[model samples]
Target chain A: MMENEVDGLDKRKAYILATVVYEYIATGEPVGSQALTQKYNLGVSSATVRNEMADLEAGGYLEQPHTSAGRVPSDAGYRTYVDALMSPEELGADERRRIRDEMRDARAQLDEIVEQSSRLLGRLAGNLAFVTKPQSDTQSFRYVQLIWIAERSGIAIIVTSLGVASQSLFELRNDLSPDDLTRLSNALNATFAGRLLRDCDDRSLTALTKSCGFGDDMAAAVRAAFIGARTQEQPGISASGAQHLLDQPEFRDVRKLRSILRILEEQRTLYDLVADAFDSPTASVKIGHELGSEELADLSLVTVPYRFGERAVGMLSILGPRRMPYARLLALASGTAETLSERLHDVEVK
Target chain B: MMENEVDGLDKRKAYILATVVYEYIATGEPVGSQALTQKYNLGVSSATVRNEMADLEAGGYLEQPHTSAGRVPSDAGYRTYVDALMSPEELGADERRRIRDEMRDARAQLDEIVEQSSRLLGRLAGNLAFVTKPQSDTQSFRYVQLIWIAERSGIAIIVTSLGVASQSLFELRNDLSPDDLTRLSNALNATFAGRLLRDCDDRSLTALTKSCGFGDDMAAAVRAAFIGARTQEQPGISASGAQHLLDQPEFRDVRKLRSILRILEEQRTLYDLVADAFDSPTASVKIGHELGSEELADLSLVTVPYRFGERAVGMLSILGPRRMPYARLLALASGTAETLSERLHDVEVK
Candidate 1:
């Protein structure tokens, strides 16, 4: 790795900077030059160590929470360390086995798997974690059941191939009975059972259901509800391990904890966040101000997209204070993404 | 309303105690005798107020946070005030209208109505709030759809009349095609469209499906799954507005806030708490130690069971610090409960 990224710091100096970052994350305290020299095999005198720390601070990679205190890594410092100098810490074998086994053991429903993923990731990472349900753009119909309600209304419950349900209520164009609805439903299901949800465009749906004895009004209303549910709905997120944040030193201040919790509760915000992270095949790291949301300015997020088929449809994330063990957490996030992808693949085959 | 409940404290003395409790709730501070006499027209002198406060403290109705501090209401004090001396604060017409309108506007799904109720109550009550999904012990089947999967397994998706879903996976007794499952499903629905779910005991289920061309194994497995889902499943809860606790003065302590959040996350604990509160027709108040959970020793919970037809099946609750305004929150809890009950009624008729 080319280590001379921060100003005039050479490879040795960058190594010193990474050690400070790692130590601060471990102890939740600043790393002084004297303590650093004594604790790590830096092979340098205290005087020389002090001079390098001062330079690192001047270069904006290190900062002091208090004027007299030793240095902690700034956001820039964390970024550079994660990018160039640091090698990811190995995720434990037991943790990996547990993640795979629990996800495999989850119920066949997509909702159950997603919920278990969030709870497991949160416990493994020791902070808040969340997973978004896969986008339905490419999902095909597993089954559809149409039931006629009172008046001219009907309900259509569509189960996706991945075991998720999308249901909508709509007004029927004709006076349909339970028996008539059942016949029409069976015909519709036979034709579109394995077809892509998006394949039911207005023109094709009209042509297709015309043979099943439904008019333009009936077809249009039903298509509107089905297409609207498939396209307009952003996947909902499941969150877990918020109580873990209480033990973090930075979140001991109740205001910071509240701000983060408030942001997590907003569904639109979480949707936007995971959407932005879904394209990255590996961990996408956003630290402090780089997160853009003011409520998240004191925290960092690491996300990785879990795939279905070839599509990167959903993402899982870990949230922690800025002084987190980024190397291990980044590894864990990507690892979980792999596990979730495998589990989702089995969901279709199951 | 009783003349007195605490020792020999009479009508005049009880009114003085109630006044102190209200004043403390408003200011979040101890009510000094002089301050109380000056602010409220008690028709008595400062000397009388001071003497009465001393007697209330001695009689266990109030306590001093500090020796020299004025007086704050104890749990016993709050109980007496809510039970006898206090008149419930009038919930405004606008507040009642808002609750009704929001609940009425919820989509025709039991789950959506319950979730919306929790968010609305949490905002209106300005604390943590939750709503339990109505129990399915008495729910009747709206519709059931069966689908065949690979390797002799099938799924049963049952929808209750109130628009809640219960699904289960079971091993098939024979090699069933999708058409066979659908035909059998229709036959079953024809016979028992709106029957109570509990009517299908193991013995009756085997006998009924024997003539439908499926073996006892399939019938028994399917019955076990449906019955397990309907009977053993404690209804899941939806909670909202936990961030509101951060602003409460008593929760300003980080430890207190953590304890309450921890308790709120335990689904079983919440299930038990709501179950205990479900039989009461009015607002059920459990203060401090009455909550019976050590983590909730500093908190108070107010619950009111919402009804389905004539049976009490679900409850709504507010959790706040022990020093909450019981008079207003109690009215709001019961008010929200009424709004939710009406909303469920519409779900069925829709």
Candidate 2:
């Protein structure tokens, strides 16, 4: 139980909490007061440190997993330390260079970028890395095409400024000849080119058909095809390096491992869990318990959005046990986002 | 330890081996002679069955996991039972109908077929179900289009009779207008339509440029774009329902789970492991030792090639514990393969 009206941490209490969290992350063991005092200069004795640890535990900064065990950082403890005590570690020069080079190689194949980014980030952070493909909700339209396939059905292709083409099969109320599809394709392209893609909605699809002197069939096909393409072409999330979790002692229990692995398999759950990455520009950490889920009480996620120009297009994130090297993993994520964004600018049309 | 030189099983011994394998799979424990006789109707006396069990153990068909424990089937035992004794179980009518209807709903879009097939098959089989995208080595080309994007580059589009389109950004040797691109696209379509897609190779790509009275730049773009699209568009394997393995006792050890999952994530390893699915027209089972890998010594794979019309276009498989119900899974695979092939024929082009 935590006291809601507790005062903020004093200087000595803050130092002890930081040292305890760091020690626990390194050893995967609860940190005792004696160990913290002996390992670092806290300017105090073990008895005095023990008293401070008890007070911190009551305030919900630390937790004793077992009655006899030493204290470890609670989720609240981790949150405060991340916000105040932890200093971001600078990534190695070689690591940052490799991220930049590999991302540049991935280039315009957005699918490859998602797969490769997860792999690189997973290996670098030594945790499960999650990446959502870079796509902007406010993308601008470049062109639209309708190709005749049969008597009344055709394929609608929409090209976006993001250098992607979304295509799907469509049906018309009346049979349209190849010449008619060609003419309609040209008219649609002229109307929507260089405009925000969201501006071309279902209403415009129907309104354009009548205004362009076409029948209701054209509107039916255009609306159906455009909506279908948008839904099917939405970018997906990739979770990589699950094997990395095998080494963590916390996941030795197969039940615990199953819950986390099950979450990884559920794409919608992962997308919702990491959706906060898109809420801000800088990297943010989500620790266990703070996520409001029982299964994920021992896990942590660090998410940062990668931008294309001024628009935040996608996210790069890492998920691991709550006892993680937060300072290092945060640095890795922010550095990767920056590198991926810079590399995207090199692609000609982006 | 196992012995290689042995004669085939006689009637009584075969019955004993089959029953033991069944009991072990269900109970997840060694099949003691006493327990087998009590649970099953072995006509002979308990002492007589025990004597046969000792003989079978000496012949290497079975082995005792511990000195004090009863016997379990060896890999060789499983092989002989699968090859000679097991009878394939028929899939339930409701299950078969579900597979057929769901596959029909996934027609036209090959990616959706792959994803949905894995999910459905994995649930039905209760194991890690793997499905490779359906594509034929001798698929016929339907049409080609070159759309101008900028001064020297455009997008290459190849539509196949499989109702699938492969597209990639391409570069040309010189600037070509929308009219020039239309002419070149027509020429290429006339040369390759309704012919085996394999007919279009690197050399033919260049030769067609000369024959069409187009510059070498056209040949350069065609070859690069076609090869790039083919490589990027190849159907990948989807390993789904990994969570289904949680109920099995064999994977209680995290090490085993890690090894198998690491294999699943490595697309190349999985592709190689199930490559034999393309070798024959029938469903085949590869037992533990038959795979010849140390990491997978306790696992088995069942592979079946799903067809389109008369040609084998893709594979459906299940990777699970060695002690599995071979008869039922084999029926499931063959049934799924037939249904997917039939559904593919509903698409007009095929």
Fnat of candidates, each listed: 0.31, 0.31
Q: Model 1: runs farther than 4 Å from truth? A: A1-9, A101-106, A148-153, A177-183, A228-232, B1-8, B148-153, B177-179, B228-232
Output DockQ, candidate 2: 0.49
Candidate 2 Cα deviation (angstroms), residue A344: 3.5
Q: Number of clashes in every candidate structure? A: 0, 0
Angstrom error at residue A178, model 2: 2.4
**Per-model TM values vs. the true structure:** 0.93, 0.94
**Model 1 CA lDDT for position B221:** 68
CAPRI-wise, candidate 2 is medium
State in Å the error of residue A109, model 1.
3.0
**Which ranges in model 2 have alpha carbons more than 4 Å from their true place?**
A1-7, A104-108, A345-350, B1-7, B101-108, B136-138, B232-234, B345-350
lDDT assessment of candidate 2 = 0.79
